[model samples]
Target chain A: MKKKAIIYGVSLGPGDPDLITLKGLKILQEADKIYYPGSLFKSGLKSSYSLSILEHYKLDTTKFEGFYLEMDLTRVKVNELYDLTFEKIIEDYNKDLKIAIVSEGDVNTFSSFSYLLEKIKKENFNVKLIPGITSFALAAAENLAPLCLQNEKLIILPRVQTETELEEALTHFNTVVLMKIKTVMNVINNVLSKGNYSIYYSEKLGTTHQFITSNLEEINKRDIPYFSLITIKK
Target chain B: MKKKAIIYGVSLGPGDPDLITLKGLKILQEADKIYYPGSLFKSGLKSSYSLSILEHYKLDTTKFEGFYLEMDLTRVKVNELYDLTFEKIIEDYNKDLKIAIVSEGDVNTFSSFSYLLEKIKKENFNVKLIPGITSFALAAAENLAPLCLQNEKLIILPRVQTETELEEALTHFNTVVLMKIKTVMNVINNVLSKGNYSIYYSEKLGTTHQFITSNLEEINKRDIPYFSLITIKK
Candidate 1:
């Protein structure tokens, strides 16, 4: 009987296949099966960033089985997704199948991998996290500025949340990274205006459609996307 | 005559040759001349990480024209280094030659590149920043933990000054990354203890001698090196 079943929570660095780490690529090549979160799109494909890296490795998703989870962040839904994924792992455990679960960014940061991690730990399955290039790092890279200076404090908050959370993060941090800017641009812009923080907005960093602007007023006038990031440096 | 001369701020990621990004590699390959920060121990030799990647491409340090900066960050030494490097770039600019300035990590993060940047901006030279992987990302990857959470705030501070700054950072941030830990471990440890934060320590992340420990008590017993990092998760 196989005594150990290894699960790798791999981060596919910000949307670029070339940006994926050598270690991440190595795991993708070696894993007996690769699991990625599927979307609710009509075609039933995985997320765009992870799919690119997986395709770069010549790994055919059709060949290996995939587990789909609803794109919801509520605790109950997240827990359900993990439970289902864990059950699949348990069934494959006796066969000594090594599984790789790929996340868009670093596994421990705003990733579904955390939920799975909790479930796996409860089931006594051994799991390891493989970190990758985060969108924040990529956005900073595109801007040619440091995200957080030597003594600078940085706050990373989701933009789709309540305005109170945004205001608190803005006031407290030396550098604030507001993710998912499309959903709450007006509120974020109003907060930025009130705080007197200059904004650097980036969309699709590293891709052909990548747009970066330091003008907050100009950004407010444009249509922002879900993947856009806004940085306010103090 | 070309009105603009390109200056590349290249990141040689985390002491590994292959870890450099495709864009970073392209800049190195295409640059008219490559300049690296020089060390007293080995003048004109490429940094170990840069050398590794260059070797794969059949490029030798001896083949490229080299410039050395012997500026120390302590006291007023950094200014002298900046002046000398800036003068070299100015000379090249006068000659209509484009230059590439490479550093070990991302150009803007806790790097000497900023000093040079200040000088260049003062002189009004056309400059472009090329991003590379930072040690923080590598450290996180080596430890297999995410550096920042979904809504969590992060603070990155170098131990260049007093502990009061660190304490202030801790009070406002959820995650704190303390760089240059060798010189200020005692003060940083005190702050971590006072804050009641769990600490993760990584020494020489990504290299053969890499060591990571979450046991703060054990960390205190070990001699922390220059490459060591202390992360406080609140």
Candidate 2:
């Protein structure tokens, strides 16, 4: 009888390598193989946030085989990616490999790793999800504002698809954190204009290129980046 | 001219010493003074979660001067505690100290350190808030559930005061994380029963005394503790 391989869902924590938890860092450094689910943007490998964080920390990646789980959903079918990932993970499991899927922020928090983990977990492989510092928390610190005080409600809208939902969330919650608002910024800005919410915007938090602005007017005038986050307090 | 004291807000990260970020750990190790905002429990000094995490990590406490910012609001007036904390901080500033306030989880996310930082920042002191892994994130990972799917809304209700608020939040958001639900567990449980939501319960996450349950029935029957949290997916 052979032992099944263990899969670790490691969170890199925002953009700073230093922000990665000791547990996460340990697993990343000790993993037999590292797998990063690259974004569907320009170049999948180039936009791999986790790999950049690992490189920044100067972890010896050459010691292990690094794999990029590139799934361009827009260009390829979802089933194709799922089947490919399923087979890849199963193959590793047969080899008794200790694989880690590096994710941004907490692995269980609106992460792409969630989809892959679902497929991996079905095979009854040993899996562990290591939590990390969330980007909203960093954005809150960058702006020197509490995400929510005592008894205050905080709504985290990863992507506000509808204007109606945005209006409702803004009205109901004490604080609203809008993530990945790049594509829908125009619509979000319009809905935000109708409300009397104080906004704090941050892009590429914890990185050298990090930007912060408390002025909603400034955020409205700028070209919002893909990684940008907006915090609105009522 | 006297140099202002530098204050660092260090987050301990979800009650696990290993979960502390490298940046937070480094600051904790090098801090000249460590100040922990004690809880109003049995003993102010004994109930410091950050201190326990430090001890768990086997960090030496002999090198630095440790201070307990004992602000028991239940027993003492807020103004009195605020004044005493202010005076103590100012006195340290006079000595040109580098004090670190050890906070649990992200300092900017519903932490008691926020109040102290507000006072310290007003005095033009240099303060830095380092982020950490939040308990809810850990709980989600423990239950192997995603906090928020691609476009799903997530609401973090730190302290749910009113039943109406809980109803609205659960009804609107795809996921609702209710923290510090000790007092309102019965009410929340009653409301939770009405929805077809899957619940994940965790108490003292990442600590040795940690508890996790997917069964809402068991959670409802048990005595909810102060450190307990409930995550509901709609």
Candidate 3:
């Protein structure tokens, strides 16, 4: 039997290096090549969340294939880049190379890797996704509570497009988790002020830069980070 | 300074022993005493999911404190038992012992550890929750899809009280995760049949006894296990 060649979508958890599962660690260590998302920074610096995790664990950086992505790129251009990257993955796979694409937090929930995942499925490639601890779940853990209790409903929204959406969710669900709320901070805070709800805000969870506060006032004192999330428990 | 006693709500992930985070494994190994839930089995065979993970990893069972709880116990009796368990944990803490309460899956989401958590807080005890991979997330991974894509909403319900709950959630959210559906299986099936959504049902995910399928016909061929869950995606 020829060596088993496969692609693994690895979830490295929120931010803590120690938060990675044993299975995830094993795959990263065993893989021949790894695909990591590198974000373009000022002064031409390219850094990726998933890549930082691999470096934190002192993994072999030589095997990493960083795909530096820019936020300003058009939807058509981004797909073209992903398609080119997929071709590279397929070329290596056919040569019997094990590939791993690293993703931050849980891969299935609001992940940029979804673009590549769709391509992998369309081409009928062998893929396995290793689940990780979600940032919102970690926020709840840091707040010393779970999202919901018995018979309670929990809804997770990416960002509130309208105040009514947030208000409607708050009315129906006992616990509401809002992710990537940087743009909708004012709108969300306004609706939340009316309800006697407890808010736990976390930014860059599990990493050295992790911030956690239950007071919304303390949160508004500064500009929220792109990664910031609010978990509202009633 | 005092030796610094603390209670850790350790989440052991879904079922796979390799699924536990490095931090969670470290705490369990370094704990002075570990509290595990033991369930009564046939022919006096007491077993626990959390304990099984520890034993499978060959951890020291001598330091284990088994708290055998029956499901049919009254709510009052359950609270009374948790109170008694809390007292024992407190006594050990006062003596400067690090206590860990092992919970299968994430400790916060639909966990029995919540009962102990309330007591730990009311009496003012130092506690930390180590987050873990949720079974539903793992189920989604096994299904090769994330729960939701960009801007899509996700709702999680624990055993629907009525058919309307499931129907309403499906109408509003892009993805619906129903947990502990054994009690409300018929109602859920009835509502799901009318929709054009795909269903992925998983039982005992990440374990050697794991079962997964997207086909509703294959799932209905046998009795669903208590640990079973279905992830509905549009």
Candidate 4:
């Protein structure tokens, strides 16, 4: 009997195709099937970074499945998506086929793929993770700034409840990276102003809409997209 | 007059020759000259990574020059290296030739190339920065782990620091990456024990001496090289 092939969760990195790691590109080329998450109304086009690799290599997208995972989901809806994706993956596994599930940035960072990893692991399915270039790296590169100073502390946080957490992070670390900044810009700006830290903000880094700004007041004046980042340097 | 060809700082990422970015490879192939740091030791090897790239492309290393930086003080040494390198680069610029300076990882992240950029800017030299794969991504991929957690915080700091600094970083962030871990294993271990965080250490990631260990206590029993990375996850 053939040993069951494993499922590889790969990060395609930000939008630029070349930023994908050699290992990531190799796995994408070799994998039997590629999977990406999408919404009910959209195809995999929303997460086109992974799609570009398949399209560039002229790989077959017919086998490319879009598993639905509602962004705003109740517990039941989340479980339903998980069950459906898991069932599809297991079906492929039983037939001695391998799958590559792609994420935008590093698989472990702010990725929905973790829920799937946990579901598959519970069923004893072997999974491998391949990390890739992160948006934070791209943002820092575009700004030509160091993420952290020598002996200076750093923290990267997604938006959390309470301004206290944001304040704590800002107070404790010399540098801070706030992901999903649209919702918490006011709180972050207040903290930055209070702490007197130099601020840098990048939106949709490595993409066409990518913009970097140092002025938080200007950032507040405009409505920013969901995929935004703010870095505070003390 | 021909536009002065721009200076590009390219990072090859760790030690894998193939891991060099497509953009970086293109720059290297087209650039009239390549510059690397360090002097010819008693051994004739100029640069381990640069030599590998040259050998792979069937180019001669003798055509390239080494800019040696004296190790007296950090800022002064970096300035000296940059001044010397810029002079050689400007000589080529006078002939309307482009130059590419290759570093080990993404040029903006703890890379010596940043010093060159600062010097060039101060002297009003036109330059462009081409970002490349960072070792953090490579190391995370090698370990098959995520560098940061979703909705959690991440902190990156150098291990060559006082024990207090390390403790402060660990205390504040959900995930912490300590680069250059070889020399400060004892201090790192002390912080790990005090903070009660699990340590995942990777040495020479993507290269031969690459090893990952979660056993914090075992770090003291082993010898670590300069390229090692340690991740403390809460």
Which model scores highest in DockQ? 3
| Candidate 1: clashing pairs of residues | none
Model 4 residue A32 CA deviation in Å:
1.3
The model with the greater lDDT, 2 or 4, is 2
Task: Output the better candidate (1/4) by TM-score.
Answer: 4
Per-candidate TM-score against the hidden true structure: 0.81, 0.92, 0.96, 0.86
lDDT of each: 0.69, 0.80, 0.86, 0.71
Residue pairs with backbone atoms closer than 3 Å in model 2 (clashes)? none
TM-score of 3: 0.96
lDDT tens digits by residue: candidate 4, B131-231: 65666666665555566655777777775467887776666667778887777777876767765666677777666667777787666666787677887
**Residue B102 in candidate 2, Cα distance off native in Å:** 1.0
Q: Which regions in candidate 1 have their CA more than 4 angstroms from the true location?
A: A1-6, A41-47, A60-66, A72-74, A90-94, A119-128, A160-173, B1-6, B26-32, B41-58, B63-76, B87-99, B118-128, B160-172, B194-196
Best candidate according to lDDT: 3
- Chain A TM-score across all models, in listed order: 0.86, 0.88, 0.95, 0.89
Q: Candidate 1, after superposition: displacement of residue A17 in Å? A: 2.1
Point out where model 2 deviates above 4 Å.
A40-46, A63-79, B1-4, B40-46, B58-79, B161-164
In the range B1-234, model 2's lDDT, one tens digit per residue, is 566468888888878789999998898777767776654443534456676788875556763443444454453565566667668767777788777878887787777777887887788788888988888899988888889878788889876877888898877788989998888876787787777888899988898889999898788787778889999887
lDDT of 1 by residue, B54-104 (tens): 556554455354444443446466466567767878888777766777777
Model 3's lDDT to the true fold? Answer: 0.86
User: Per-candidate DockQ versus the true complex?
Assistant: 0.39, 0.78, 0.83, 0.46
* 1 versus 2: better TM-score goes to: 2
What does the interface RMSD come to for each candidate? 3.0, 1.1, 1.0, 2.4
Question: Model 3 chain A, poorest ten-residue lDDT window?
Answer: A38-47
Candidate 2 CAPRI category: medium
